[model samples]
Target: MFCYQCEQTDRTNGQPGCASAKGNCGKDATTADLQDLLVHALKGIGQYAALARGLGESDREADRFILFGLFTTLTNVNFDAARFTAFLREAATTRNRVKARCDELAQARGTTIQPLSDAAAWQPGASLPELLAQASTVGIQEGLKKLGEDVIGLRALVLYGLKGVAAYAHHARVLGYESEEVYAGVETTLDFLARHPTDVNALLSHALELGQLNLKVMELLDAANTGRFGIPQPTSVRMTPVAGKAILVSGHDLGDLHALLEATKGTGVQVYTHGEMLPAHGYPTLKAYEHLAGNYGGAWQEQHSDFAKFPGPILMTSNCIIEPLPLYRQRIFTTGPVGWPGVRHLADHDFTTLIQAAKALPGFRETASDESITVGFGHDAVLGVAGKVVDAVKAGKIRHFFLIGGCDGAAPGRNYYTEFAQQAPDDTVVMTLGCNKYRFNRHQFGDIEGIPRLLDLGQCNDSYSAIRIATALATAFGCGVNDLPLSLVISWFEQKAAAVLLTLLALGIRNIRLGPTLPAFLTPNALDILVKQFGIQPLGDARTDLAMALAPRAA
Candidate 1:
């Protein structure tokens, strides 16, 4: 039941992970075991799926199942052990379907199927205890004694990176975007894991390759979102509540938020974006709905207090859901890959139940004073004023750029990001995305000339925007991205940040600072490899890091 997949995982007694009855994220040992088993089952599906794809046979359903299944195992995404049990059974069924298809294709091609690993042939147990027993054999620690920490750590890196990729890919997939290459990449990586190769270099190489795959997935997602909702534009969103029946939409699914917005159009229910959904306000199509109020609360880590205080039904469209407090437990609903054992789940984007609950609950009885935040400074919006930005840089009006954001958590060390952003020199501009920006977004950074000093590039899902802006700026400057006067100060809480980090590394970006803590799964040897190869650094004092980033040598 040991798990250290997120930044918030307990390290009491110098333990490597949360091995107690309940993890720091509130996921119990049983749920953790079930998630591990589900991953093992997905590896089986991947083995068969990869084989099938190689044989000129493809199962789209099986491929999608792999993505969604892996996404569910991400930190704080799904904590329902029963849901994982069902997923295990479904994984076996999906694997069998792909296996049958592969066999048929091989027979038709007059080619014999190759022998497979235990994951490819394994079956799930009928009961929870039996499944837990099976899971024990496949846990991440299973090979530690023989393979050692370095190999296991690298494997964990690949696996966690894949989970992040799957989460992003799944979001794009829901909006009718599909990439066969991305699917193949995922299946191939999973198949690689199934074989349990111990070569450190090979594992590291595969992880970088996963990062490239994630870049592709992120591109597809960007297209899916922008194509559906139009490119995000600079828009001001209200931070204060308006009087009405309200439904607070959280997580990162724009499609779900759109559906709920459409459903409650004339029902007097105001849909407020929460957490990662805060960026939705910048999308033209989503914002077109007058009833789509504005963002509520802050990041995922504050949901307990935020949700309890919010006077409306809350819908979590994706990951970063916590154990719901009783105050709002009945009013909180889940969709997509997010789950809590007793929480009501809305499937197929049906918002009727959610809308009804919003009506029944007491929404904001009176309007709060008007306050707002600016968002939608995505690549399109920012690059639209490329001339001014480049001119400012050349004129020395803007001295540096800081990309400070990632998944935020309640860790006290997270205060470093807030201070880092706050302490940034007046001549420097800060561009942020993900929920982490909540720390300093409210602060008045003003702007360099006409360009805002703090640019909100939307959700972690909008990481592609950050990459795009960086590459574009690099192009304009006639230099490599790293050579540009920009620094990435990231605070990661979960797997999505892992994927984003891999993408940055794969792109040969270096000297990025990552905190609040290094991943527990990364042995010192593995950390050393990353530092030596990519110049990845553990974050230090915000002021010191900022000074270093601005030093003449850095440029």
Candidate 2:
């Protein structure tokens, strides 16, 4: 099996990807192969679903299944080969249902459907070995001999961007926010990929179009979250644990956390947020629970130590799950698209077993001293002070703005973000989102004219908030977003971050710095296209990059 979907992929012997028995993320060969086949199956569904939609017959189930199936194949989301095997069969069934509907629609209209691609008609194998054999033909390198590395890399870029869009759309979907436009965009993009187009310009166009689709999905998600939980407000959250029987919920799913909070309402179980769930505390409805305790850990990369030490059961609601160690394996549960072969998974928002496990475990023995940090500087909170912010800029009190954040990983070179945020001049305000903010959030940056220097804008799922805030600032100053005194320093580890990057490029935002490392899937030519088109640059020394961002030309 070969996979290079994430930043941490093995790069042995000048190779660009992991081709060994296990990847750097701990996904074994078998699971990686299964994920490949699952993607192939989803493309088959897309081929039929796209045609059906054109015939004026759309299957909502097929649309939702396509989004969810692609999400499961994202980096570190699902590693259970058996789960993916089942998903393959489900994909076939879902495709067949859509195919039949398409046929019926054509019959009613007396028009013949166009000839379909192989992906639309391919059959799944009956057993695991047969599936593995089939996977070999559809893997990432399948087009290398015919399409060359550059075209293949561009395809990977489009596919990975779609994976990010699917993940975000799925999160909003679970909260009952549905968009027909989003469904159509996803279906057509997958269908385009199924055709195996090799033109570099076409692939780049599709990538930017996917970016626009991602922007819409982000907006829908923002609405879903704010509609359900109300707009996030500035609130300080405890970083230390409180003494009680406790349950820790991680990932970016606020819906799951709300369910657990309601379930444990009167049970003496204290619920704590972890990873990206830290921003849930800013929501009025979620924070209203008296027993809803504060956050328990840092980023997802540190979960091994964090989960092991937390004296309670843990729940992962989405991506960035690693192989669980024995110490906390029994108490950790997974939901939604995340899976590990032996880990217990909670389905349909049921937390009975999870709550029971929390009750049996020893929670924090004594209350720790109050240690806290403030969150909830989303668009609403930030823009509410737009008048003051603009005034400060005119008065020459605020010099620049830095949007420094993205997914964090355990890989080397990530320390650049920490040092960069730490060394940022006091005159600049740093706005951050995603788990990467954990790098320097605890540091006291003070404030300028009563506005906090560091603003935490929810999870990676809340990137829309960052975009909204930036656009608002530009509007207030009577300039384009690129003219605003803001610089984006993003650290990406997986697909969702890829989608966010595409959104930025689609909006014509330029001169953004991205690292710890560039994605291995991008060939040099492909990377050059991004560089020339979007002015994307790799991160350099923290001091040098900061100085460059603050240069007079940049201003």
Over 1-555, each residue of candidate 2 has an lDDT whose tens digit, in order, gives 988889988877475888899998999999999898888889889989889889887889998999899999999899999899889999999999999999999999999988777888878999999999999999987777677788888999999999999999999999999998999999899899999888899999999999999999999999999999999999999999989999999888999999999999999999999999999999999999999889998999999999999999999988878899999998999999999988998899899999999999999999999999999999999999999999999999999999999999988899999999999999999999999999999999999999999999989999999999999898899999988889999999999999999999999999899999999888889889889988899999999999999898723
Write down the RMSD of candidate 1 (Cα, Å).
Answer: 1.0
Clashing pairs in 2: none
Best by lDDT: 2
lDDT of residue 228 for candidate 1: 97
Clashes of each: 0, 0
lDDT accuracy of residue 308 in candidate 1: 94
- The C-alpha TM-scores of every prediction are 0.99, 0.99
Off by over 4 Å in 2: none
Q: Write the per-residue lDDT of candidate 1 for residues 14-133, one digit (tens) a residue.
A: 648888899998999899998988888888899888898788778999989999999999998999998898998998899898888888899999999988888889898979999999
lDDT of each: 0.91, 0.92
